[model samples]
Target: MAAAAAVAALQAWFWNERFWLPHNVTWADLSGEPGPPGSGIQYPRAGHVFSAFPLALGIFAVRLLFERFIAKPCAINLGIQDSGPHRAQPNAILEKVFTSITKSPGGKRLEGLSKQLDWDVRKIQRWFRHRRNQDKPTTLTKFCESMWRFTFYLSIFFYGIRFLWTAPWFWDTRQCWYNYPFQPLTSRLYYYYILELAFYWSLMFSQFTDIKRKAAKLANYAKYQRLCDAFFMLFGVVFIVTRLGIYPFWILNTTLFESWELIGPYPSWWLFNGLLITLQVLHIIWSYLIIRTAYKALMRGKVSKDDRSDVESSSEEEDVTSNSTKGVLSPSSNGSNRINGHVGSGQWTEEE
Candidate 1:
């Protein structure tokens, strides 16, 4: 609601001739018939800002469809497993116990849980193993996700450089002040802003999906921790440089401070600056969280798992899928012989 009000106020200010005109120019001068060819001014179209919302929605829909149909299937074919069967889900009480207690139960504890759930010990063990595997994303899936983000960030960074390199605001920060609200927003600028906004929106949308995969598991602790650490460092550096560095040093400085010299104090100016500052605050908060995580990694020499992650619900179906694959065996005679030998050894050990 506040955002809507701010946009509306900005629109009102943009269309107001009194706010935009120089001291000498009047509405009469602007409306005068047969004005000198060079005397007329091109007013900014405030309505263009409203177009951003629709563009954002279109981008989101396209991203959703692309991920669901194209990207997901491609990843799956590349060895990424999707959620498994629905019947693998445990009852509510068991699920709650599993989540709250140990991830892996063994010895007497495992037997107790098996008896409580009225399932065989082997089944309980398989469930725990499958649950752990579900929480760990395949290597190919991680690569695909990282590559997607890297591509977007690289493209946007270069595009921003190309667009702003020759701009007056890039050279002389005070130039942003000179035009004030009368500066028309070009198509290039509009697209740039919308794309940046949409990228962040997409990140927020997919955040939950990847949260469980962010930390390393005990099974492959060393290898996974290194990968997690490297990615975290990369993400933190990029975020700090882009959001905390360039944005405040260049964009916010010009819009909030330099522009004030020409525009003076007005509700629209304050509102716009307020929004920019609000974004900066959010960036700071996120950076703080990232820093905290980095500190923990540095001190403990490992990435700590986020316990609040929604892995419990997601692991249920994954367990079923993994268990179903266990029944399949190689058709080769050598494989059959090896499996038979293993089964014979297990039976002998059980009898002893």
Candidate 2:
């Protein structure tokens, strides 16, 4: 009941008219009936966001099916084996310490655990390390997960281009603010908005299993930078140049100042610009990491792992490296926080 009341209060505060429309504008002003009064034009509503919840669930269901039937099959075809990491040896004593207690027990704690398990301290440490690796997602799982996202963004990209190509706002920036908030919500834009929201919802629902590690691939890329120098360098250049160079001056300028000059100050306008600015902040933080990686990479002649995401742990690294001729970059620290410590993923570089 307390939770329910809090939710209700939040909804009320969020939907408050003064926080959305301009001082002279009320919800009623944009509620369909135009001044000419022949046809009623539907404007965007706060309730439209709520409608995305149901669609999001539906999209989530579709994503599960897509991964199972489509993505998994594709991964198998590409020679991505579905096998998981090596299992840790069975030891109830060490398992408890690894789980409820500490993953990496101190030397003294290891001595105590070693006695209970009747195993050497090194054996106990290996067990814990193997246990940690077991939880990490397999390459097959990562491929399937990323494939789902790739399909989604690709579809949305074409859809966005098609919609934008026909819009007056696409050609002329003035069309965006010409009629202001009174502009009617078209069916195409409505569906476009919902599908995008739903795709993100799919990610949020699966965030736990996936650990939502956005930079996992980044670490993989850094593993063999000599082979992927072209791709990795291109990715870094595009990421840094777009976010740090062009975004603040071109995109941010257009969203914050240009929008204000065209539409005048309004609550919704401020909210829209605020979100754009907040996203830019994420870009800046990630940019610093990318730059840091590039500088070290230039000096070291090899790229480092991403410091923004979870660092992979493995006593198996030596064994994994022995199989390949190329040298793997030094592993990043495992104690780092998630990218920006946020719900969604951000970019960052790893260092040895």
lDDT of 2 by residue, 73-148 (tens): 8777766777777778887777777778657697677788778768877667667777877887887777677677
By TM-score, who's the top model here? 2
Off by over 4 Å in 2: 1-12, 33-41, 213-229, 267-271, 295-304, 313-315, 318-352
* Residue ranges of candidate 1 with Cα displaced over 4 Å: 1-43, 53-61, 68-70, 85-154, 194-225, 242-244, 305-352
Per-residue lDDT for 157-221 in model 1, tens only?
79988978978777888876675444545556767877887666656666766533332231222
User: Clashing residue pairs, candidate 1?
Assistant: none
In order of appearance, the predictions have TM-scores of 0.53, 0.77
What lDDT does the true structure give each of the candidates? 0.61, 0.71
Model 2 TM-score is: 0.77
Worst 10 residues of 2 by lDDT: 338-347
lDDT leader:
2
Residue pairs that clash (backbone atoms under 3 angstroms), model 2: 305-350, 306-349, 306-350, 307-349, 307-350
